[model samples]
Target: MAGEITETGELYSPYVGLVYTFNLIVGTGALTMPKAFAAAGWLVSLVLLVFLGFMSFVTTTFVVEAMAAANAQLRWRRLQNPKEEEDDDSSTASDSDVLQDNYGQAEKLPILSVQRRGSPNLFEITDRVEMGQMASMFFNKVGVNLFYFCIIIYLYGDLAIYAAAVPFSLMQVTCSAASNDSCLVEADSKYNDTDVCWGPVRRVDAYRLYLAVFTLLLGPFTFFDVQKTKYLQILTSLMRWVAFATMIVLALGRIGRGHGEGHPPLADLSGVRNLFGVCVYSFMCQHSLPSLLTPVASKRHLTRLVLLDYALVLTFYSLLSFTAIFCFRGDSLLDMYTLNFARCDVVGLAAVRLFLGLFPVFTISTNFPIIAVTLRNNWKALFHREGGTYPWAVDRVVFPAMALVPPVLVAFCTHDLESLVGITGAYAGTGIQYVIPAFLVYHCRRDTQLALGPGALNKHRSPFHHTFWVASVLLWALFCCFFVTANIVLSETQL
Candidate 1:
């Protein structure tokens, strides 16, 4: 389970944790946000985005609190079972020995009574409890399975979005180049797969070909353990910074020159549903909390650290979206904003235009295999039996195959990036980002009360500790589901 404390050395400062969290929360979702803002109206989008960022920050606290509780519980169980400690020589004995010694001194103490005493060191965030591990600790079989199901769905959506995005970008740039040397900056100029890119080859065929090439190039990495090297991450981070800075500066310059053509409505009710989904997706970091928080050297200001990160991210999102909406007309903004600057005229330099156009291609291609392997490992963990080993073929091939196929097929059927992002974020992203953390915190608090007695205090408890906050998060998630579903149904009927 991912939530169990592993002995990975803590090497990062809190600042590094802040950087990682920032990077994790801002990804492909952020790129789609300006278009969402354009559609929803900037004022409405601003209010909703801030509210969503706060909600995400609240849930992140919930996850970290649960993580501390999970660690305390694991330590308590080990203290109660001294014989198991004696049997496992490879275990880290010093910490367990100190805990056992404390328990032995108060031999007549009730189980976990030491924790109930509110020992300052008892609930330390030393252990790495993955989200799945925390689910297993606090949830029953049914609840645990639900957790896995939500996560699996979210990861699948993530893969599908990545699969579609790269090929779509490639097709857009290739077709635009083949059709004319001049860039297509006009709002009404849209291309489809049925449009010709080369001699007798439609854009749709070209998309499939690119998708195939993408799969062929990156798919095999899923079969092996894919570790993202430090250099690779650093390189991608640099590209990300360059691409984002260029877009923002370009948009701001256009707006400053008074050439802005945008006149987005004050409120577009039709776009509100998708805007909610995009915001949820953009602020998501809850699923990766355990991995992110575990390596931090200190926990004293963990919540404050998270708060600052979200503050910076929200400001960045606002600046990016506002500039975009003011610079480009709502109808002209592409789903991927980088494409708007891909024109040689818009950007002037061919190299810069090419870089902007291929930005998604460079970043998403790196992520595809890593995400695919993660999905594969999650599948193995979900159905895994105690002390059971999978067959060679099943372990090596079957899981990776299952993880890679469906998303590619989805990419084949449609390249509607906005709809894909909206639907995925609305449903599974809602589950992982909002519902799961709320429930995990609720259950963890209850379990802590039962084990450590009502008087026990968890040092890492969230600032939003009231029961009302838990109910509020769940209620918000429920409302989002109903709202998104109604919008889908109404759209279908109108169609």
Candidate 2:
């Protein structure tokens, strides 16, 4: 059952692939965008969001191009070394004899005929070549290790964000009534862990308790191979659409009624750093391309499909954020935008309020175990030795334990989802989204030139195929890193 669940079979259509990509990219990050937009001002957020969306789409093509190149290389190597399978047995001929035989056969075949028929789809990005596998194939030892480290850090941040979001939502919803607080209450008012939730328990204590309960419930799944079933994905995706649509309609209605309160600045440079992180995080789908794209059939129009997907995603984000900024006062918007509509008076229904409040608990909780398992698998792959296997205890226990513990500890210390998303997206997220893709495409192009001659071309190469594009991506990544680092240092010094 587990094997079936975790199998990487190519059974999905391109449309399904698009939906998966959409869902994956539009996770917890979207929930934070409203706050980032409010802080940074609508115009700055709008420009940055569109630019980042296009940039992310560019990198997506880079990864797909790399996947195709990796596949072609794999096919070429197999064709060149056809005797590898038989070499294990003593009856096989020597390497020189095999090579001579292959050469003789190649001499008999026409070059164009071999190119046309020998491996017709050699460059098809159909195989499940994961990012890590591609890194191992294209990069040196140091690059491979760095790729793993960046991905691992991003996944850790993902886990910690998930760990904190659910319990925080639960604490908010459950404690709101007890504290006699309305959702419309000032957002700038900070809630402390020291504030009482029950008789003697503070809200922070309730938050910790909920985190403990959340860990106990979902943490065990990391110790085993757990695949999110298709049904769960469908349900969550459906719920996401419903929740987002509801908020947008409600906000638009409020704005139409002339109750809108937002009066944002043109551009706020102070907030650009965090907004950059939030936008980058919101558009992240590069790391999961293998899982999403491998199953996609009829990928001849994949680039177009991806472009359309990004168009829809960008439009959706704009609508969500614009409605948020216009409908509620900038100061009243919650970090999780859903909470803004969680009050009965605001949404005008007890059931809707409950549903909106518990939305994160359902959606984020469903993703936690899956992300944890992915992190665990990546960890195993990072230190994985060829032709070797781990003992059952280490395989089952240690990797998952390592994956689960640190993120939980981070969650224990802070529940600031904004800063968490910002730091994670700014640092590790930038590497995975921008830097790694640039390097991967560059190396893949160079490798293809060497292997297939200069005239050889990747059919799926990104439209931004110029050397300048790769250099631009790297330079932009460097700028973001320096900008974020300076911001962090300034923030620390101020504190």
Candidate 3:
């Protein structure tokens, strides 16, 4: 009741803004980045990576800020439809006590259409509000929600890779308990049955089963609502920090163990290129936009925020890659920080092992919620009714169900870890990180009014600046379309 209101009378916060930005940008990709590095080769990949990061940062900065500005300047009527306006007029029985100038009665309701129930339906209040209208709206726009499904598929693929190899790695360690040969080596191979010991259960199906288990895990996760998954958000954040720490320690361990070029043969340009794509995908947390704007810093503060964010991300990525190259060279590099650290007997092994062992649990926890929410919201919007508002409850019911359904239907589609990474690289990678923001940038850059903050109606700018932005917009659009198409084709062909 006492917060800053937008033109539509919605509350805005700066805390949510920062959280949304940070969360949107980080995820499971952090765990798999090493694998990407292994494929791309450090030298060639790093250069391209730095450039990509810079482009993404700049583009994202311009687009998100501009959207905030545009939303602010629009009149309340422009934001919502006639149905919403009518709903507002009927509700808000407290209109007689208009104490706040910021409060716009007509704009209080969102740009949504609800079902016409009984007369009481117009004013019925429930403890839990339905917010699925937007979800339904989203699907209508994006065709089949394939992009959202892709995330669940990717996560399932990761689980499959882990299941296929982790147990085998453990078996090797137990069999050769006293030997120096790494248990992980046997598991890392594309082929599963290289028996270092006489009695190790090495078979092709074993690896296949591992892949199947992972896929099975993934199916259910994709079936639910993304907005409702709270545990997923927490676990992912925890995993991020854990992955970051483990990567550094593992690199040091590899270095200490005398692994040298400091990288494996497979960690080439192809591998690193793949990793770059994964990093971009994992770090994307755009869904947290509502939460990120919870804080209230001035428009002038955004430049500093962008600068700090880029610096932190770039520094972490560069150091992590360098450490990876320094510690494991050639075909010996691991796919994840956990895989790397699992080979060592260092003090950090306890934390690393726990993370590795429990990661699948945490990973599967969120995938379903994300998918269901996205779908549910899209469904509501398309139907022109209110969707479920509480994402957490929706996720609780939907996440597990989604997780279980996929594997049952597909017989747990199996894929290798690297193959999974490649799929994501070709699909979600190009669209979410590179394409969407680029399109938004191109669309918004022409109007200088967009460049100004929410108070743009009162701001001033030169006509020449608008021309400059127009040229800039065209350049970026061309680049985005070209690269998106290229990346898509190249990824599938592995070119």
Candidate 4:
């Protein structure tokens, strides 16, 4: 399929198939979905996953419909000016020429203007509404940024804490059970003692925090700004594979080993539920929409690809979740990855630890380009030209900005891993992922197409479409409330 061309040489490639689809399947969800499952039971969690999948499906449908509507507007516009090379020849006919040929006089012909040319399609407008609504619902950029920052801080910080803590925790358990000058003590040396620092930081916590902040910087500073970043796209795709493999290996290891000393088996129903949510959210990858949209051959092709890609992603998540739950039976799904980290046998633990540690690094690398892209698109616009070049301004300004901001806030936020994950989940998840998409769909369907002429314009929306708008809006509202109250407030056993 050929791409749609703009007036300039730039081709509209929004919908590049599997690569974009892969990005959508990975991200923050991959980082913390296990936590969501840990909070809820497996049986209940699976059911919730089904519901979330349905919502995601509906949201995807809404996106497709909006894209279609926009394409239709473009088609309508093309018909009005048939000779314009920008028009997609397949969808539009030469209405003006046909009128002139048939009616003999173009002035006498009665042109039917069902819709206007160049109007914002329901989807584009809805996308704006959704973004604005998300920013607003979270209250403001400062609050939203703070909430997200806390999450990155905690997740990264905890990754460090746990890396060191796992070995120490095991040691404490071993020493308390063993006699004085025991054989286990003899086996422990500098080589095996997890405390050996390779850098200035003596503590693993600082190392991990730095790593987290480093990874966290990627998302905001460099993802956009390019017409396309094929190398970065390939890197993201590789991370997708790595995340999948690591998720499987760690999940299985934890599940099979079951539990550590004094800890219950890793099959708690609450944890299972949380895991399911995390699986759906993590594997779904909603944040990569813009990238996925690029490289689409046609609007029709893009729709088919999205539906298929989402279905496959859902299947992958379900299988992974099921395997993890079945293997580790008990209330131990909470902190699933940590269980894996803790359970790594001494013989192979070093390699396993190194592999597990790479997750945060990979996550950080993946997000850097994404953040850069976002800044270039949104913030840079205030100063720079819409499509102007700014010779590594993003690197100089945005990269440094991301590096400094999160750690500073982390210093203030207090690094409790669970609390940070929950708070970020509540604030960012509620408004950004769930609320906004639903709102955009609702607004797009209900709002009339902006008319450029003067006539009654209520014909585009039907009752069925209106119902979709209402149902989606209502569903998102419920999720928003649940996420905010349950996850953000830090109540007993809720998040």
Best by TM-score: 1
**Which parts of model 2 are misplaced by more than 4 Å?**
1-10, 83-120, 181-190
Q: Rank the candidates by lDDT, best first.
A: 1, 2, 3, 4
lDDT of each: 0.82, 0.80, 0.44, 0.42
For residues 367-410, write the lDDT of model 2, one tens digit per residue.
89888887887777677654567899998899999999999999
Clashes of 1: 5
lDDT of 1 by residue, 123-202 (tens): 88886666776776777778877888888888899999999999989988887887777663323446666878889999
Model 1 gets an lDDT of 0.82
Model 4 per-residue lDDT tens digits across residues 1-495 = 345563212344434455456565644454455445445555566676666666565555554444334334334544567775244332123322211111100111122345543343422311111222222232244543443343333333323222322333333323322332322221222222234333433334443455454445433343333233557656756755775676576556655676322222334453442343344345333433532453354443555566677666667666665555554433444332333332334224444444453444444444444333333333332233323556676645764455345543453344233444444444444443455455444544332244233332322222235565546656764764575565334546654
lDDT of 3 by residue, 388-426 (tens): 243665545544444444433332343344545544543
Cα error, residue 250 of model 1, in Å, equals: 0.9
For model 3, where is the 10-residue window of minimal lDDT?
123-132
Candidate order by TM-score, decreasing, is 1, 2, 3, 4
Using Cα atoms with residue i matched to residue i, what is each candidate's TM-score against the true structure? Answer: 0.92, 0.89, 0.62, 0.59
* lDDT head-to-head 1 vs 3, winner: 1
Query: Local error of candidate 2 at 221, Å?
Result: 1.0
